[model samples]
Target: MAAKTWASATRDGGQSITTTSVWSVVRRLIGYECFETDPEYLLLQSIYEDLRLYFNFFQPVLKLIAKEHMDKKVIKRYDGRAIGDHDTAAPPYQQVMAFKDVPFETKARLTNLYVQLNPAHLRTTIDAKVAKLWKISW
Candidate 1:
């Protein structure tokens, strides 16, 4: 399992950060960037378990989905600002989920497809569907 870490900068010229610290920073960032009343977060939170189970074995696929469906400009800004500021690693989906614009139906589809697909055929199905929509082959 990946450890949740917070991203931070050291004021006193300290050593580099660990994974845990990076997660802490990201959580704090999201606290401000995302809202408590946001329905997207609530929806994603509700299905987090299903997402984790299904995507756990297909992180690359999820990344591909993010690349295709997520807002590139916003993600670019995030990477340049918040992500660049972090000294430790952060999972791609954490940043991807920050986009509340992604429809709930898409999330549902991604999660449902993962649950229904067999492992051996998972990538092909996902790739084909995503490629058809995004016009890019994996």
Candidate 2:
């Protein structure tokens, strides 16, 4: 019904609307038709597409979140994308939690094991094994 009404509306200064220009305002509002040339908008669009390929289960997602605000900073940057710097400086998966507080021998041994198996594949294998051990099927 709305589309039907929009198709017959008059344009600026009482001019008849063209067939292609009917509902141009609604098209821009709903589809961001005016942002076709926006750089940040295009970048965000690409990021959204790429993120669709990444899906994973997170471990330890508990309310250790409360510990996040333990350290106060001089100023909060508000929005990461606004500053154009969203890098968390996280180490690669193989190196994550590798040498934390463990004795040199143990750390090196575990790190050697992790490196032998690629970290990404190793995580899947571990998750599968844990599921099997717990009789989890999905």
Candidate 3:
């Protein structure tokens, strides 16, 4: 996983900077900057798991679903970050339970679909007729 930051200039002369009010940054980046909280945590990714959100969610189920079809180690190598952190390495039971609104069950797969809509899409009318959709072959 790539580690990136919004404001990652804390390292200087191999020492951790406690404050971001350095004269160099004021003259260079923002011209002037002030912060209410520690910019390191806010602007910089201090936690390792910040990048692996979707990978972590799907990691648990991959083993349960794909073990017979694929190698587990190879799957981890592709889907997982180099080092496991609080997010990616966390056990599935608690994380699955943390999901809200929809009913979650132990023996069933939880399928989620997210849609991004424009105002034009909303203006289009719905078809109203309800029917079960099976596989479509053309």
Candidate 4:
């Protein structure tokens, strides 16, 4: 799904999109760290695109470690005021697994993928790829 669409679907009222926040991190890695000058920056469009593809490869693994805060309930007062109560933070994988409507086979597939992931290794790979981009930019 497109990041904006996903964000719109999941975000609470008046809350900022998490995907937008995450994109800033991507921008810092690719834009700020890679290019040093305006002229050089224009020449590195291919590199930027390549690095984006590389980053996306590991993005899901990175998200495996990111905790998402889930709201459990909205408590309504006599005056019609409502407050959201959050549940414990969990990774997206766990949240999917916790869903009653998710099919058992689908959950099993996710579990299989989850077991093969190592967050430390994924981070190292992302760092190495970003460093590679830095090298190519110069």
Q: Write the per-residue lDDT of candidate 4 for residues 56-126, one digit (tens) a residue.
A: 43343212223334597434432122223333444557657768999999988877866776666656665
1-138 per-residue lDDT for model 3 (tens digits): 223234456644443322332234222422232322444323322221221232233335322222222545533332243223332444243356565754755414432311232323322211110001011110
Clashing pairs in 2: none
The lDDT-based order of candidates, best leading, equals 4, 1, 2, 3
TM-score of each: 0.23, 0.23, 0.18, 0.46
Misplaced by over 4 Å in model 2 are: 1-100, 119-138
**Judged by lDDT against the true structure, how good is candidate 2?**
0.34
Quantify all predictions' global Cα lDDT against the true fold. Answer: 0.39, 0.34, 0.30, 0.50
List model 2 lDDT by residue over 13-117, tens digit each. Answer: 442222222244323323332222234333323322222211111221111112223357332332232222452333332234544776777666656754564
Candidate 3 regions exceeding 4 Å error are: 1-37, 45-49, 57-110, 113-138
Cα lDDT for residue 107, candidate 3: 18
Better of 1 and 4 by TM-score: 4
Local error of candidate 4 at residue 93 (angstroms): 0.9
Error of 4 at 124 (Å): 0.6
Give a tens-digit lDDT track for model 1, residues 34-135: 222334333323333333443553443222212222655534233334334443433444334556887888767656754664645644544444334233
Worst-scoring 10-residue span by lDDT in model 2:
56-65
